[model samples]
Target chain A: MKARAFSYFRAATIEQALDAHALVGDDARFIAGGQSLVPALSLRLQAPRLLIDITHIGELRGVRREGGFLRIGALTRHCEMLSEPLIAEFAPLLQAAAPFVAHPAIRNRGTFGGSVALADPASEFPAMTLALDAEIEIAGPSGSRRIKADDFFIDLFETALQPGELITAIYVPLFKADQRFAFDEMARRRGDYALVGCGMLATCAGDRINDIRISFFSVGNTPTRVKGAEATLIGSSLNSERIAAAQAALEGDLAPPENDEVPPAMRLHLARVLLGRLLGRLGESA
Target chain B: MSGFDENLLDEADETVRVRFVVNGRKVACEVAPRETLVDCLRNELELTGTHAGCEMGACGACLVQLDGRAVHSCLMYAVQADGARIDTIDGLSESGVIADLQAEFHRRNALQCGFCTPGMLVNANELLSQVAEPSREEIRDALSGNYCRCTGYEAIVDAIDAVAKARNEGGSAT
Candidate 1:
């Protein structure tokens, strides 16, 4: 299916993009990398009147260290996560999740901000953002503001971003020397969206998990953060008994809806299995 | 007599001008904002070597290198590619980077129906360029996005493996 005809505007700056979108009102959609948006347009799932091409906007591209956080430009492509030195040194969780996202070709064009802003329940980056305690920066006509990832994603394909507001960058606290991270997912195929995926970051002191943040995707509306399960593992060394307790705590954290492909019961089972495996790996790595 | 559907009329009248380099040659054309790079390539420039199996990004038949990065042409707008350099199967075939892999594919019968060969070759070319002697698992991972309904992929892996070994051994890619 062909997309509905639309006017195109290549924005040279953030202000230009905001002005274009504001002029077009709600009928305008920002196109960066165009990995997910282009497919939606081709399928006619969305028919915006104006496509604000923001890929050329210099302000929206790069990975750098700012103060205590790694400020990754919204337009940073998925492939850049693999090569960017700052990301490797600071936010290694993103680097770990990069290969599991789609494939090399799709990764070459898909953007970090686009993935997080889209907030697909099954996508890896959004959930990883939660695990990493990243903050999303938004620029609007009035002014710019930063919000925690926890409050940013509200629902399926929904975000706190107001109309005419563009995500400018994602700020992640630089990884500490004692921090340990792990990410894994179970997919029918390598490149297919995961059936159940999990990412975790823990501050380890000796053998005990001092603090940990656990996030799961493909099991709920938003990237489900298992705070209850995380609480179970905090301050305790990862052992078989503690892993079992954390796995049991998932029942309270996630309420994944039933789907045709995988029943809700089976999804819960897979989530438990995944949590166990991830915790096992985290124990070894720590 | 068919009625004049307003939406159809609107789509028919809308077109945008785009210019980009394809296979080292600069080309310009007028296309709709919705026109994908694969459509612009096949219909406008007459470069049909890049096939479009799934208009969605899944099938990978519409794979092309944009500014040296491999991407799905079907999932990109022609205008979005403006001022960019693109490389397609036609360019790669003539560039001699995958001549050895092509010959090995022929020798191993890696292709059956031949619909997925161009995309497979493009993906394999990328893999061999990066890792001169990639293991079988790495080749599978690289080609995972591309779907081949024919030849079970064993022969394809063998073909890519042979090329990787030959290239690593200081032999030219035919």
Candidate 2:
């Protein structure tokens, strides 16, 4: 399949990119890495009149620690998550999820911001961001604003990102000394989109889970955090009975959708199984 | 309206000049914004060693090294690769970087139909370069993106594993 003809503009600066997008209005799209956007464009699912290449924008290209958070540029490729020392040190969950994010070739070209901005329900980074309690930085015609990962995702294939808004970077809270993290997903094949995936970040006081965030993807319209499951383990020790209770509490948290390939019942069952397995790992590590 | 509707699709032939290095040689060409690198390589330059299968980026048939990074050529627009260095299957094979792996593939019969060979070699090169001695599982993980309908991947894995072992042996054996 071939994409419809579109005008192209390479942006050297974020301001140039924003200005170009504003000039084209809804007829333009910002392309970085292009792993997702190119596929959509080829399938003719999206045909913007102008494609503003943001890969060359120097300002949106590196990772740095600012204050209490590690700021990851929107243009950060998925493969970078595997090797970037900052990501490995600050956001290990994203690093763990990197290998599971598509094949090596796609990972080389897919950007972290592109995945989060696209907000595909099945993607790993968005859910990992939610687990890490990251904030998404956005720049648009109305200046810039930061939205928490929890509030960024609105629905399936939809986000709080307004039209013409560019995700400049993702600011993830630095991993703490006491934080214990684990990430896992069950897919039919190695690089296939996961049937069910989950990530957990818990701050522990001895064996007790002081504060925990458990997030699941490929289970709902948006990457979801199981607050009910988190509640069951918040004050409790990592024990069999507590883990079972949290697994049982998953019913109140996620309602995975049914499709021709996978029924809702099966998806929910997989989600529960995945949750148990991830929690089991956390419990062992604890 | 559909995205490919004739009336909606622009046929203005708008093109931009892009200069990129392919196979260690600098090349400049005029390409449309919609032209994928695979298409540019196959159609414009007649460098047909890079095949175009599942242009949607699922198949690794169009794998190429862009700035030493293995990427699906079909997923990238030519304009996006402007000023980047590319190493295609032909280039890598010609340079002898993967000569031993190629010999192993031939010895192991990694290809039944041979359609996925070029891309497989490109991916294997990247894997060997990154991982000093990749295990069978690691080779499988690295080549997960590449689809080989024929061969069932066992021979392909055998070839890569053999190459890794041979290389790890301090080049004592071929």
Candidate 3:
């Protein structure tokens, strides 16, 4: 199906993008990479009056280290996640998940920030952000603010972004030497949306878990952090018994929505199985 | 029909002028704001090799090189590609960049109806460029997005694997 006709504006700067969106308000969309938004347009799921192309905005580009965090620009494409050295050194979790985000072509144009901003429940990057304790930087007419990834995603395809506000960058705390991470998902196909996916970052001290954050996607409305399971593994070394305990704790954490294709019980079961596999891998790495 | 307002169609009539380099040649076109790069390439420039199987990014049929990177042209509006360089399957074939790969595919009978061959070739070219000697598993992984209803993918993987070996050996000799 063809997309409904609309007007287009190429914004050279962040301020120009904000101004363009503000002028059209709810009728306008700030497009970067255009991976998710363009498909929505063609499907007629969303028909905006104006598309403010932010790809040319000079400020929203690059990957660099800022203080203790890795500042990943909003326009940083998915392919860059696999190629960027800083990401490999500091935010290795993102690098691990990058190959699984989509195929090479989609990865070539899909942006990290765009994926996080879209907040699709089945996507990998948003959930990985939670695992990394990343912060989302925003720019708007009233100026800018940073929101934690934990609070940025509200619901299905929903974010904390206000009208005319644009996600400028994502700031992830640099991965330290003591940290280890693992990410995996079970998809029918290699690049299809996962039936159940999870990513975890853990701080270890001689095999004893000092601190760990676990996030699971494709389970519910938002990427879920299994705090119960995380608490179960903290201060303890990963053994079969410990992994079993953590797997059991998932029942309390996730209530997978009922669906015909994959029943809620099956999804929850897959979540447990996935948690076991990821934690087992993490243990091996540690 | 009598009450249909002609002014309501005004937005559809609006066109944006975009200029870009396609397959080593400069091209210009006027397109509606919602017109995708795939549509622009096929309808305006007659580059039909870049098929549009699924408008969404899921299907790799619309893959093209945008600034040297293979991307889903269907997922991008024409206006967004202004001043960028695009290379479609026709361009790549004419340039003989994938001549060896194409010959291998043809020899192995990797494609049946050939609807998915263009995207497969584009994606395979991308993978070979990055990894000189990709294993069969790597070739299969690279083709995750490009769907082929024919040949069951074994022949396609074999063809890519063969080309990788040939290219690597050729490279090492020089």
Best by DockQ: 2
Collision count for each candidate, in order: 0, 0, 0
The DockQ scores of all candidates, in the order shown, are: 0.39, 0.44, 0.43
Q: State in Å the error of residue B102, model 1.
A: 1.2
Give lDDT: candidate 3, residue A4. Answer: 79
Candidate 1 chain A: worst 10 consecutive residues by lDDT? A19-28
True contacts kept of each: 0.59, 0.60, 0.67
Runs of candidate 3 exceeding 4 Å displacement: B1-12, B171-174
Residue range A1-286, candidate 2, lDDT tens digits: 8998887777888888888777778888899988889999999999988888899887888999999999999999999999999989988888999999999989889999999999999999999999999999999999999999999999988999999999999999999888989999999999999999999999998899999999999998999999999999998899889988998999999887768888888888888888888888887886
Model 3 C-alpha lDDT per residue in residues A100-183, reported as the tens digit of each score: 987888889889888988899999999999999999999998999999998998988889998788899999999998999999
Candidate 1 overall Cα lDDT vs. reference? Answer: 0.89
The TM-score values for the models, in the order shown, are: 0.96, 0.97, 0.96
| 1 or 2, greater by lDDT | 2
Best-fitting candidate, scored by TM-score: 2
Candidate 2 on B1-174: residue-level lDDT in tens?
112222222532577789999999999998988999999998888899999999988889999999998999999999999999999988988898889988999888899888899899999998988998888899999999999999999999999998888898867225
Which 10 successive residues of model 1 chain B have the least lDDT summed? Answer: B1-10
Q: What is the DockQ of candidate 1?
A: 0.39
Q: For model 3, what is the alpha-carbon lDDT of residue B122?
A: 92
Better of 1 and 2 by DockQ: 2
TM-score for chain B of each model, two decimals: 0.89, 0.91, 0.90
| TM-score, candidate number 1 | 0.96
